[model samples]
Target: MHTFSRADFERFGQLYDIEFRFPAIHGDNSTDDYIVARGEITEHSLASGFRFTFSSLEVLEAYDSVSCGHAPLLVLVVLDGIVRLTLGSVEHELTPGTAVSMQLHPDYPLQAHQPEQQHLEIMALAFDPRRAKLGHVSPSLHGLTILPRMPLRQWKVPHALQQLLRTYAGLTMTGTQKNLVLEGVALQLAGLGLGSEEQESPDVPVVPVQQRQRLELVRQHLEFTPDHDHSLKDLAQMAAMSPSGLRAKFRAMYGVPVFDYLRKCRLQLAKHYLEQGFSVEQCANKVGYTHATNFSTAFRREFGFSPRQRTVDQKK
Candidate 1:
């Protein structure tokens, strides 16, 4: 078994030009071990934001369980596929559009994949709450209060949070433009996670006549670019409103959050592919899942049957 600490992770970068660093653990491995798998770990430390990471992994073998962390403090955003982890006897999962924070613990159990070449894509930020700058977030961002006692807790990562992660995860900008986008999104996440939560509201506002058109544009963009990573704040900016305003208006207009709408689009597209004789892997990639299992799981959940079953019916 190959045990990895900070230095070993860094070597994956230095030795192979991978963006990696530590506080992570991957059991035993050798250079040749990567032949059956392909992945990347990108870790960056923002001058103004917290330390964060983006990982996309595809594993063909699942004999030895791979795990990471029990970190000092961390926030996680799972974009695709199932995240597997165990704490003592309890197991936890982070699906798409969910956020979570974990504190110091001995071992928090983990794995990057399942059998059948399942892929996982995740973005995580490591932080110290006492010191992170939360910017101008509302006081009601406390959906993350699990336990100072050492366990995992779920947080409904808002649309803005999803946008922030997506914007950064799929960014192609550079220099000042890149930094501005990163800093802006990072601050949003900090505020969303660490900000003092506001009380829930039963009554919501109606969208203005002018704002309705803009929200339509946002929806259209998501529909067309179902695979593009979108940031809620940026989309709101495009819609000429505050992020909150855009969210309210969009729900009023479409009755679903931005990504939820996108998911429906992706699933529909996957169905078309399945009927047109595309393989599950091809359909998964076409629809933005890094792994086939994740795609199948999502497809089954959305359509109530496995993609394989769909394929069989298509043949029949």
Candidate 2:
């Protein structure tokens, strides 16, 4: 296993952004944004032409948008925490137990939101679609189209598959045995994540390009400044739509109600604060909650544990 800390990951990001361009250019080309403030990412690459990464890290800061490099195809499984991403014009949220199989285009790179303070554990498998010969392994990916706005598939990860990944991560093996095991895992992940040949893309409502761009502004506001007490009228004005139109279209496009998304962003940041040794009341106020009780209730509902409990657990 190859382990990379934040500094190492940042250096590689810089290199990939600035110098590397053999097979393809990867990593977001940014100067100021630090990817992670804590934790590490471990990777295992197989000779069978697949690379798998297990990343456990905390976001250094909140970003409304960050570009991800070109990959022909990628299967991402959210082991824990939430990841928000935009492909083409559609925004998606990946929670624990969820996985996505996406066919990415070079021109329209994937845009991501890294939530501040939130700890994330993500497992990603990436490969070149042209050379992967996935048809022989899984017939479903045979005719997968490579589009700028491709039809990606989202599904729940099986419990057994999750256990298998954890098991593989713990195993001590090398050489041919490791390669064989990795090949099998790769196939299984791809088969389950993107296995349905008949899986149809969800019907995303077609809004005008101008309206979509404005809607994105609203989303960015909610994501980046979740602590603000945003009003629907103001947000509607920002999106150049009626309040109801904004409400309906935002949900239609982003898969969640507008304010509901904001609540999630706030709670995610609050959780991060609690992990960093902040008091429950402090976290509640910081995330715009007037009452600590309300914040505690919401936090427990969202994360299945109280803020104080999170702090205690971390100490242990």
Candidate 3:
């Protein structure tokens, strides 16, 4: 995390024309200006070869009358005070320890209203979804996506994300390192958004007992023989189900499909082996890849870093 003193903040305020007021909306007498105190922008790279940005803003009694828009996904963490956010017909009242996310586009209008005698402190991160690799696997998240505003009590922030945010606040990182950190933050956020929903609601569907047994059997078989070149048909036969049924059931049970989960498990094993100082070829073979290049490509695609690059990053 980069720290900006008052002087540094003043310079930024002057540069960006901060504290400017806009016209009143709906005939309200309240002021429409925003006072930005401090902020920082940073980026991070992921093992999956993606880069993202993490940014934060500290403000006091900020208000936006004129609707402004953003292109990336915007996640706002309200640390203090109350902020009234209106998106389309929805109105979200955000308070301390609240998080609200929205897909920012040109058409959406966002207005902020802060009552007098109170200060609003918010930290926000914006990132492009295209570069985040969210679209490739989850087509439903391909476009602008907005997560409902949730209190911290309802949705617990993962420890990894919390640590990344802390690192963003203090680390004296270079541009490349910043990108890496941002990417890490994005990955963590995505995991939180996609992973937690299933665990939160038990009503969604579960695999039948027989199917669950088959899936567990397949996982155990993979663990026992990681190098086996088993096809979907073979796994489906082992599960006593058709390939399509297997895919659907696995996706319902887990967030990802069976093959994707298998690949991810293999890549995680490869990463562990690599971290233990195993050679690239050894890690590749241990993870069921016949060719080292194939493993390298898959590792990069999944984690945003090649095995060699990850090793170097781990050392650093």
Tens-digit lDDT track of model 1 for 1-316: 2232334444553642333311222455334333343576677765443567786766444432433433334677777666655333234556777776655332334332233346666787754433345662223323222222123456778876676676665678878787666666655655555535334345756555567656756765665566666788789889988888777777765567777877877887788778779999998888788889988998999999999999999999
RMSD of each: 16.3, 10.8, 20.4
Q: Write one digit per residue (lDDT tens) for candidate 3, span 98-161.
A: 5665544444455556553234455555545544443342454443333222211113455555
Best candidate (score: lDDT): 2
TM-score quality measure for candidate 1: 0.42
Question: On residues 89-111, what C-alpha lDDT tens digit does candidate 2 reach at each position?
Answer: 34678888888887554444566
How high is the lDDT of residue 301 in model 2? Answer: 94
Q: Per-residue error at 25 for model 3, in Å?
A: 14
Worst 10 residues of 3 by lDDT: 145-154
Q: What Cα-based lDDT does every candidate model obtain? A: 0.60, 0.69, 0.57
